[model samples]
Each structure stands twice: as C-alpha cells, then as structure tokens.
Target: MFDAVRNNRKIVQIFLVLICLPFALWGVDSYVHGGGAGEDPASVGDTKITAQQFQQAWRQQQDRLRQALGANYKSEEANTPEARLAVLNSLIDQRLLALEANQARLGVSDEALRNFIARIPSLQENGAFSMARYEAALSAQGLSQPQFEAQLRQDLTLQQLVGAVGESSLVAKSSTDAIMRIEAEERQASEFRFPAAQYSAQASVDAAAVKKFYDENARLFQTPERARAEYVVLSQEALLAQVKVADEEVKAWYDGHKDRYQSAEERRASHILLLDKDKDPAKTKAAAEAILREVQAQPAKFAEIARSRSQDPGSANKGGDLGFFARGMMVKAFDDAAFKLKDGEVSGVVQSEFGYHIIKLTGIHPGKQRSLEEVRPEIVAELKRQASAKRFAEAAEAFSNMVYEQADSLKPAAERFGLKVETSGWLAKAPKPQDLPAYGVLGEPKLLKALFADDAVKNKRNTDAIEIAPNTLVAARVVEYQPAAARPLTEVSAQIESGLKLREAAAQAKKAGEAKLAELQKGGEDKLAWSATKTFSRLQPLPAPPAAARAVFQAPVGKLPAFVGVTLDNGDYALYRVAKVSQPEAIDEARRKAVEREYSTLLAQEDFAAYLAALRARTKVEINQKALEASDR
Candidate 1:
C-alpha cells in the first residue's frame, strides 16, 4: 500500500491536497474575479483556489474514479455541472481548514519535509534514498524540487490540525457495551413466502392501465441521439510505426550509456536481533554483546542461539538469515559492518534503531556488466522511442492545423499523415463502449460534444483536432446522424403491459401476506407452508430472504411466537414467525476489544468532521457561481 501511494504520485498529491484543504487559507477577491486573469473558483477566509489548481484537482478526481471503476467508468459523468460543483465545494472546505490551521500557527519544518520525502519507497532504490530517482520522478510530473517540497510541507501542516481533533475523540465504555450486546444477539425463526408468480397467474393487465403507465413514463422509452462517424487519430503510437532507428544509432547509444547496464555487488548476511522493546538500553546491549562474544568464540553455535533468542520474527526462524541484499538494503551501521567482514566471519555487537545486533557474513556475490550483444534489443527500443517522440512533436501541430483547414472531411488529414480514415458502427451521443473502433474518442465528453455540434453534424464537417489523451489527438466527421426521439407506444406496448401485470401481482401478494400475518397474530393456524426454522444474528446472516431474517430479530420477544411481514425485492411478500431469541452468556474479550477500536475510530472521524463544520461556520466562504460553472465548460 505504501509503495502504491508513492508510485502513484499524481493521485497521492491530489488526495493530499484534498485531505489538507481544511487547513489552508482562501482569498475572497480571487473568487470574486472568477476564472478571469488570476481568478479562483471559490474562496474561504482570504485564500483563493485558482482556476489552474481547481482544474488539476478535478482531473485528479476523474483519474481516481476511473481507476476505481475500471472499464465501466465514464469520463462524461465527471464533466457534469453537479460533479464540477462537488469539486468546487471540496476546494472551499479545504480553504476553510487552511484558514483555521494558519490562524493556529501550525507548520511543518524543512527537516521534517526532507525526512518525509526520503522515506517514500518508490523514490528509493534497494531500500535507500536515491536523489537521481527522486528528481526524475518529479520531472516526469512537471514539478520542481521546491514545488513538491512546499506541497508536502503544507500537507504535513494540515495533518497536525486533523490529528489534534481526531486524537481528542473518546468512546464511552457504556456505548461500546450497548453496541456489542445488540451485535451478539441471535434469533431463530420460520418464514412463509407469498411468491408473486402465484398471484401473477390470476392477475390481468387491461389496455387502459398499460397505456396510462406508458404515457406517464414516456421519457424512459426515448432513444438517445446517435451517429455513425469517420475519424483519424494522431498519436505517439501511430507515429512510432513510421519511425525507425538505424543500426548505427542503436550501437552509438549502447556505447555512450554502457554504465547503465552494470549491476552493483550484493551480499548475504545474518544477524541475531535484541529489540529495544522499551527495555533498558544498557541491558539490551549487554545481552546482545554476550551472544556476540559467545558466537565469536564458537561460530557454529550462532544458528542455534539465533533461533532460541533473536527478537526479529522475520529472520529468527531462518536462524537470522536475511538472504541476499545489495549495499543499501540494510541500515547504514549494519550495512557497513556486514560489508567489511569476510565470509564466515562474525562482527562485534553493533547498535541500530532496532537495538543491538550480532552480524554473520555468510556469502558474497560480485557485480558485473552485460556485453553489448546481451542488451542490443533494449538499446534499439530506447533509441526508436526517442526518435518517435521527436517526430510526434513536429507532426502534432501540422495534424491539428490540417484538420481545421480541411473541415469537410478527414481524408485530407489522414492522407497527409499517411493514416487511414476509419469508419465506426452506430454510436450513441454517450457511446457505451470505451474502446469502440474509430469512434473511441467519442467516449471522451469534449470530443463527443464537438462531434455532435450543430455545424459539425448538419454540415458533415470534420471537428477541430482534440487531445483525448496525453499526446493523442483525434478529429471526427459525422457520416450518418439520428436525432433524439421517443419510441412509439406500439413499439413498447408489450413492455408496459408486462410491467403493469407485475405491479398488480405484487399488490396482491402484499395483501395476502398481511392477512396471513394478522391471522397468525390472532392465534389462528393457516394451511400456508412454512420453511424449516433457521437461526441468524447480525454477525451471521441467513442465505435468502434477508428481510425476513431482519424481521425475525426485530420482532417482539414477549409472545411464544412473534409475527412480522416484509415486501421482498422480487415482488414477493414474506411473513416471519420468530420462535426463539438468545443472547451470549459473555462477550469475547478479543472481539470486544476489536469492536471497541472500530467504534473509537468512527467517533474520531465524526469529531474531525464536526471540527471542520465548526471552522466553516466561523469563516466567511464565497463561491463565484459563474467561475465555478465556467470551469466545467
């Protein structure tokens, strides 16, 4: 999880910005200007959320959602007015928190920021900080060292404010006990289902009722506007197909960057760890030194001593063997000692963060560089990629211009770029498939909007080239069009009639189930068939009829058999007769503790939410409606 957080820096940065919003200031004047020269989407207190900043945040949210929903995700949903407004509101909340944090004089120090950055696993190599990798990652994201550091500092400062509120929350013992009692309660019950299918055979839907239902819900039967189109794409992948790396170029690259193919030396070592564990440092050190002295005198006993006494669980069972590791894999003190010792030699007691350790150097592997022949394919691919990138830079401008200039068709642009004008199957305004051939760009809201624009559709003209993805441009022209229209009643009459009959059946089932339940409550036994008794609890639920299971637990326990009725999802109605109720004799301590921790965490979250709400109440928040709406456009 930590590696994922570090590798997905863009997503993590956006999440930090959002989570830290409540601790930043906002400028009222920025919001008033509203997406103008130096305008903001909203403001809290006196800090402004700039248009660029808001846009980056919105895009980050879209990316996060896309990742979560996978192929089912749609970019068009995030482009809506409501979605944009939600993003703006989050920015406002962030500004409110920022204002409060600033007034409290909360801050993160330079040393703390450096430490935090150094700890990111993705920015490290072989478990050690690597400055080159860190710089390269930031450069890839278009952020400088100072810019990234400043954001990190801001995030840490906001964390301080959130921590204070969350830490103050306390869960009462009485509340914990009450919740556990209910959660542990169990009940046994029998149920009878009044299946709607039984009633449907007797119920009939008339023409008038079907027509009324259809007329009231006409919008549901309307077909969305659709089009068939021809499009051309200009992308790096497309350009790569036309790019070639000569043998000489590949050889030259390999010669100039031969050092990149070299691997560092690695060593395998073992150690008996004596963890600090809040014990006296001197005592811990003395114990480790005793083991070290014993091992030095008789190294053969090292493995037995490690298995019996080592505190490091990860390696203790393996006789403290850490396996093969590079220079930077271990902490500095431990790494230095292990590297200096000869194979089969043991080092004196050394102190580190985890306390003292007795090191044993077991094996060593020397580093080597690969020959040219071994890396020729890699060199060729790298060189080819570089060539294609250069070509894309030069051709992108020409592609964009050609599409706009030759507006009638994609043929001219396609021919100029040595590309084919691909045709697509019928596509809805909001295309269902994200990977639709030729019309894949229609999955993107902006391109779809442009393709269906009045002039583009009516004149059958090509759209201006639009970047649907990074370094990928697409332009489309409508070949066939269909306007939005409602499906006639004749076409949907059967569907409406079926729906009306189901509704009538459901009504009959509910009536019969209620009558049966009343009869049961009045001490009258009906000939209705009841399922076998089943036991359930909040923690252990029944397989079917969850509503009946829930009703069993909720039914009154005074009578010998308590009765309740519920309408099921599949148009069936269920009547339950709860026969028994039981409570645990005693709460399991471990389970109770787990539940307590969860309840406490929930309470802490509530406290944090209340704290933010209070900050908003105290501060003056201004949202520029026009600017907020314009950001969506």
Candidate 2:
C-alpha cells in the first residue's frame, strides 16, 4: 500500500479516484439547470449568505485550482456552457460551505496558520522558513504579504472545520466488512446491446412531434446569461517588455563587479615518494633522499621512478600524477612547495604529516583576468531586470488611475494610453484568461472585496485602482448585463438535439440487445455471438470502457429478467444474462484492514458534509447580486 501510494502514476490515479468519489454522494445527475435564485449562500438564524463572502470563497477556490494545475490549466471537458456552469457551481458550493464554517466560528488560530506556512516546502530553505524566499514567491505571484496571510488564514479555517468533522467520524467493523466484501467480490455476466439505428427506420420524427418537444422544453434553447466587461490588467512581464537596458549601464555594472571575474592560479604536479615512515622513519627518509638524488640526475626518469618506488598507493599506480588543482585545493605543505616550482621543475624531498614527498612540477597554470567583453551579456541582463522592475511599477500605477477615472468606457482610456481594454464575458474568475499573465491578481482577497462592493454594483462603475498583486492593479466596469433566466429552446436546441440523439441511440441499442439476450438465454444462439471478451471482477478495471457490461452487472440477478441490454461506445448493442454471483463473504484479514481505512474515510466525508450544512444553516449571509454582475462587466 505504501509502495502504491509512493508510485507517481499510482498516486495520480488514486488522487483522481478520490476526487471523483465525492460525485457518488453528491449525485452527479443533480445539475444546476440554467439559472434561478440558487439556494441561499448561507442562512443563519436570521441572516442569509452574502454575495461578498460567496465571491471571496469562489475566488479563493479558483486560486487554489490554478496553483494546483498551474497557470496554463484548463478543463478539456468543460469547454461547453453546460459543463462550464457545472464546474463553476461546484466551486461556488465549496465556497458556500467554507463561508458557513467561518460564520460558525470553526477557524484556525493565527499561530496555526503561521506554522503551516512556515512548514510548507515552497516557503522553506534547508527545512526552515526563509523570509527572502517567501517574499520573492509572493512577489512572483503578484501578492502582498497581507493578501497571502489572509488567504492562508481562510484556508486554515476551512481545514479546521474539515478536521473537526473528520475527527468525530467513527468506522465500525461491520461497515468495514461490507466495504471489503464489495471491493473484493467478483461478478459473472454476459451482455447484449440494442442499437438505436436499428429502430430509426421504424421510428420517424414528425414536424408536429418536433414542435411539441420544442414547446415543452423551450427553456432549454434560451440564450445563456452574459455580461460585458471593461477591465484593465497589469502584468509585470508586459511592463518588462517595454523596458530597454543601455550599453553604458551594462558596462558600468561590469566594472563595479570586476573582482568577481578574476580566475585563480592552479598547479598540475606529481610526486615520486620513495618512503613509508610508519614502518621505519629513518630508513624511509634516507630512501626518499636517495630516490630524489637519482631523479635529479635523470629528470626524465621521474615517471618511471614514481611507478616503481613511490609510497603513495593511489598516485604511484598512475605515475604519481596529481591532476591540476588550485592553490587551496591541496594539502598546505605539498601545495606550497609545488606552486613555488616553475613549470616542469623538480623539488627537494619535503617532510609533512603523511611522510616525506619528493615533488615535481609537471605543469603550471597562471591566473588571468576575465575581460569586460566576456561578461557583457550577464551585465546587460542585470540592467534589463532592474529597468523592468521600475517600468512595471510605473505602468501599474498609471493603468490603475486610468481605469478608475474612466469607469464606463474602456475605449476612451485605452485609446488615450495605447493600452488594450481586455473584455471577458461571464468568466467564473478561476483558471483566468490564459493570455493575461497577471490574472492571478484577481484571486487576491482585497480585489475580491472591492470588486463585489455595493457602489461598484449600483452605479455599474469601474472598480477603484485595487492592487490585486504586487506591481499589478485591476479595475473593471460592467457594460452589458443579463439577469439569470431559464434558457429558451432556440438557444439550447443544438444541445438538446445532441442529448436526444445519444439517448435515442442508447434506447435502440438496448431494445435490440434485449431480444438477443432472450434468444441466448433460450439456448438458441452461440456464445460467440455475444462477442468474446475478458471477464472482470467488480474490483478490477472499471467497466466504463464497456458500458454494456456495466449495465448488465448493475441489473438484479434473476431468471425472469434473465438478460440485460445496453449500448457500447462502438455504436453497437450488447445483451447479457447473469451467470452467477460469488457468495457475499467476509474479507480476509489483510483486505479487511484496507476496507476499514476506506470506511473511516467515507464516514469522515459524510460528517464533513453534515458539518458544512449545519454551518450554512447558522450564518449571517447577505448577497449583492447586482454587484456580482457588475464586476464581470
């Protein structure tokens, strides 16, 4: 289990499975259709959920997702209006719960939040909190210290709530047994599918039927709610692009830091140590002296002498070669003597800690100065970085003022300042615009607070220059608006058509497969006709890949309904009859332990949901729907 948890691929699969598990309880089929007054964001004894808190939590969740998936993250399946709304509502629900938790006074202390931040790897250096690193990261993310603190505080509060509920959860042995039994059980089955295409010939769509369907579900075709927005975005990278570094500045910088470019002297030398003092000190010295004299007479024979007589085991095997090294890299006495010798020169026998060593200078490398031309590129980069920092600050301040002064119209401000007015219609404020580098600023608590302010909503006015991030300010005003309403048939006709086509296909497939299943059960058809396929246990690979198999397994096992029919992704239908079900049994000890852990998790989740519900039922909540709509504009 530990190994599975440690494996990257396994961990990822587990994480995804865990994330999806919530849908089982939440009921994925319960969808938010178009819009209406959603359930109260919160409901205390007398107060209701407020727009301000909802937006705040919503923005926080967005930031958390961005942080988890990276700035470039987008949900591939959520591009359509329905899918997008589903994701947005899920985020909103989480926020609602978090706000409720806060109102119930289920929050973490400041000290706890501080400790948590300090322990985070991203904010630590060598296992300790690094103020410098924390500051730099906050700067990169375009966040102020206070903003980060507030976010951390809120997160801590939510965690506290979850912890409280989870702590109270209890898992009984019987519950674990049940879960274990299901997890380890296997099912035997066969399937038949009924294809809709088979029935298309018999099922004709008439104009009158189409008109009736459209009339009954007219709301499905209505246009989606949309709001026009005029927003000013400040990104450091954009500001940096306009900054230019001068050659003179680069040169001056290079001059000031010239000392850093100097290279140190290095020596390449070898020794023929003809001594081993540990055995006999006097004899070792005499042997060294003798070998030194011999090498002095025949200098070129030093390499041969080293190989045959040197007492240094490692270097002796390699002709006593000590590869090139800087002054401080070698032992003090050996280094001093070697450096003193000129290139290709020999030295007298020197005495030191190991023994005595006759040194020879195989080569000498002189220290040299690195010219300014060699490091001009580095200098230029430094200058540009400095210039960019200044540019971003100035541009941000100017951009903020412009948006604040010209609230309703972005054209006037944009044209005058040569700045582009970015427009986003009904964006949920998470996984923000990919093209805008500073969009993370929108996640800041202060920016959320200001954007949802009553004045900004009532007047449909631009937000004041609010610092969403360091060196980045944002101000936005609504231009166009649409109150949430049930969608009309015209607007959702295409969507309904697609849904209808899929359901029809499934229905047709099931009908045909049902007949096939009945024939197979009557022992009238070959098993091969059912498509030869691998049989799987309930705990094995998910049957999602084989929808027909899933449908058959889910059906009650009975002789009367001897077979089940369903559609497969390959545009085919399949019919399956129940073969046999393994008797429900207690799990083995090992499996039981695992199931116990899972049961504990399930209980905790249930408790947490209940806790959130209770919190929402007792909080002071007020919402400015108009303010929320205005900010998007």
Candidate 3:
C-alpha cells in the first residue's frame, strides 16, 4: 500500500539496512537477553512481547526522532502513556505477522540471503564484495555474522507476506471514472477581502483589560527550572592520546599477521564471444578457435575482430573489454583460463553459460606482501589503537566504581583518570542544542533523571557514571540549583496589552464583514473592490486563499451564481462569488492509468488494514499496564 510496496525490491533493500543493522548498533547490552526476566508488556495469542524488546524499540524510536527533529526533539515526550502504547501496538503487529509467516512455511534460502548481502553497497570495495570490509563493519556494530544474517532472512520473509497482500488489489474502471469526474470539475470565482489591519486604529485597550489578560495567562510568564554543574568525561579518544606503543610490539603484530597485508593477484583480459543461441555448439566452438588463431597470428586486429564478432552488448562497442578483475570475481572457468595466460598471450576456445569465448590476456599483476619498512606507520597506528582500547576498558570500570564509592565530589574520579573538572553554564531539564556540550551526561535521559533525584540535588552528591554514548562515561554534581518561579506582572504588561489589542481588532473586522455580506445578499452595494475571476479545481489550485477556494467549490452549482464567506488565516474575512462551473472534456489515457494505479493502491491499503483488524479480533491480546508503565521508567 505504501510506495515501499509498489517499488518493492529497492525499498526492501534499503529497509533491511536501516532497520536490521541499527539493532546491532545498540551495543552489547541489547544482546544480553532476548526477553526480559519479569512480566511481559503484552501478549499476542501464545507469544509474549518482552519488556526488553519494548524498551529497545522505544529507545530506537527516540534516537530516530532526535536525528529527524534535531534541536526540536525532546526525549521526555516519549515517556508518556500514548507513546508507550503506540510502541506496544507496533510490537503486537510484528508478532502477528511473524506468526502468520511461520504458519505459511515461507522462507529465504541461504543462496538468496548471501546474494542480498553481497549486493549491499556498504559492504563493497571497488565495486566488488569485500570480506574484510564486511567483517569490520559488523564488528564495529557489535554483531556477529550469524546474528545479522538471521535478522536479514527474517525481514525478507516478512516482505514476502506483505508483498502478497499488496499486489492483489484491483481497481474498477467505473470507480476511477467517477473519481476523475469530481477531481476535474472546475469553478470560476471572484473574491473581496476585509483586512483586519484596517480596523486596528479603532481598537481601544485600557489598563484594566491588560491586567485581566495577564492574570488569566500567568502560566506563560513562568521561568523554567535551571541548574549548573561541574563534571568530567572519560572517553576512548581521550585515553588514546595517553597510550604509547613500542617498536617491538609493532614488529611482533606485523610478523603475526603478515598475510593480512598480501594483495590478491589480478588480471586484465578481453574476449571475442561467439553466440551459441541459434548456431550449433560445434560450429560456435570452431568459429571461436578460428578467431583465436587469427588473433595469435595478427595481434593488432583482435580489437577490430572483437567489435564485429562479440555478442555482449555492454562490451561489444568497447572492443569486448571486461577490464581488470581478481579471482572469484568472475565465473570459475573464465577465471581459470584468463589467469593461466601470460601477458599479450591468446587462449583457445572456452565454453561458458553464455557462449564460446576466445580470450586474450593483456596484463597481469602478481600478488605481493609489503615489507615492514613500507608499512611501519600503519602498524604503529594499529598497535596504539589496540592498546588504547584495552586501557579504556580497564579505566571505565574504575571510573564507575570511584564515582559511586566517593559520591560527594567529582575531584577523586577526575584525579584518578587525569581529567580536569569543568564547570558548565546554566542547564534546564530540557536542554537547548547549544547547552549539550556543557550538560554532558546531564543531556542523557537516564542520567538527567538521576541528577534531578531528590537526594542528588538537595545533598549535592555526584551521579553514578553513565554511558552517554558508546565507550564514553560521564558523572556530575550539582553546583547551583534554582526552582521554577513566575515573573512579576509589571514585566509582562506591555506584551499582554499588545496581544489584547490585536484580538479586539480581528473581532471588530469579522463583525463588519458579516454586516456587509448581509447587506450585499439583500441587493445592497458596497465600495469594496473585487479581484479578477480565477479558475480552481480539486486538482488544480488557484492563487486565492485556501478558505475562499474551498468555499467556492462547496457552493451549490445549480444556482448560476452563489455566495459564501470564510475567515482567513491572517485574521481577515473573505466573501467568494462562484460564477461558473465546468466539467472536463475527456480524461486522457495516460492520466487515467495513473489514477487507476493510485486508486488501487489506496484500496489495497484499506484491505490490508481491515485484514489486520480481523486478525486482531480473532486473537486474544493481553496487556499488563503496570508492567508497561514500569518499563518506561
């Protein structure tokens, strides 16, 4: 029903990467337990939706919203009952789909899964699948190969079920025709606007009116609660600068992993392909052999002959060049033949799935390993990175323990890690974008909750070390705190007066416009000037205001001319006179087909929604409200 279903293959590939891969990016804690140890958040039929799964889904959604909304995103908004229920419903839907898929015995084969992984552009190097890059990427996300592959296979299976439901939709021609008729119907209209600004000079406001407004809206004048803190950060980058690697360690690592630096052999080859589609196999092979002999006899004419004889459309115009390729990149038979030939040498006829090929080897690059001197800088950097990682792991535990054991001040932890205690500017519970660096761990939800705990703020104790991001620990102590308070009425009187005056002006304008409309309907004339007539339809928008356009289309068509009035967004009023209504001559074939496709997609979406509703009704869904609320905390 979504465009993702219509353009199924490409969209599914993108969805697989974005959805499945990010599960691994959630870190090692995500994989510790597949389900929570306590009560379930929800249950679908016989299966339970675990608390851990719901929590992970909530966090992933929060991260996605933060990225999309940027500075406008607030993490606390996700802690509400409605947001938690939405997440629970999504988990229930996924469980239902997975149950159906399992019952149907639908699956993805290993070969198909491998091919899909190979095609992912992120795992490739130089347009070819790189095993080293693939392993490194998975390791960086903290996922094993089997874990990623299993998730990918499950997603592909679910896509098969979704595609089956979406592709079966049908659209009737009569329905399409009826829709087009209404969409193509056009109206011509004239408008007269009553501007609110014209009445502003007549509006009067006194001190009593301003005082009443300010009293009723006192909440708008309150200042938010703020706090300032001193904190320290222990991150991997900070530790990396302190780590030092010796020359002997670098040499030892290089010697143990010498095979990692060896480059694979590559070959550059061109071929003349003879088609076996209509001709006999023997004849095709004989022709290929003849071309090979001619090429061997006259090497310069190989390109000329290939251009006329090759059957591959992609390479025929380019003299049948296949470019340079490493082993396992091409078919086994072709790779074997090409690698066996020396530079500037020709080979006999070779048979493949496509046709018979007369191969010519133009270049060869032998496999070689770099000397330690040539790669000394790279080895040293890798050794230092490895050493830094080990040190960070050891220091992270110490940092957490010290902060907890010595809860009064950050000075002990900072002295232990050699990190300076830094002071931050005023920070609110909901920090702005510019305050993120100063707030540090206070910007994170869990740490912010802890920092605002009754004891931490009142007693001036330090928070427990929190992992704000991967491998980054932070802890803070409150240095100053201020409670929320309301500002004095004198400071906000001017704003209140200005707001009340504008509202009074808009009300006066609306009253005058209504009186004028009534007089015009009773055959009286006014001095207001009307704009030129413009045509509009449901599909083709006019330059008039949206309220005016909507009124023009909704007015009765039987009456030759009709009048309608509406309030515009600028606090102005508009009266529209509908003059003429016209129907389209005919619907073009191309546009009709497009409309039919769109209509069918809408029908399919409704069908799918109904199907899901039916499935929900048939199953017994039990939700633990208390457990759901506890999980949010």
lDDT of every predicted structure (CA atoms) = 0.78, 0.60, 0.77
Instruction: Kindly indicate the candidate among 2 and 3 with the higher TM-score.
Output: 3
Per-residue CA lDDT of model 3 for 298-396, tens digit only, reads 898888888988876656777878788998766667778998999988888888655788888888888999999898889888887888788889999
| Candidate 1 local distance difference test against the native | 0.78
lDDT computed for candidate 3: 0.77
Q: In model 2, what is the error at residue 415, expressed in angstroms?
A: 8.0
Per-residue CA lDDT of model 1 for 422-483, tens digit only, reads 88788788656534554556667778889899998899989989887777889999999999
Worst 10 residues of 1 by lDDT: 1-10
Candidate 2, which segments miss by more than 4 Å at Cα? 1-193, 201-225, 262-370, 394-402, 405-419, 423-458, 464-474, 490-505, 527-566, 569-572, 575-633
As for lDDT, the candidate ahead, 2 or 3, is: 3
- Give the TM-score comparing model 2 with the true structure, all chains together: 0.45
> How many times do residue backbones clash in model 3?
0
Model 3: CA > 4 A from native: 1-168, 174-192, 204-215, 240-264, 270-321, 328-340, 344-360, 366-384, 402-422, 431-442, 531-563, 576-588, 619-633
Clashes of 2: 34
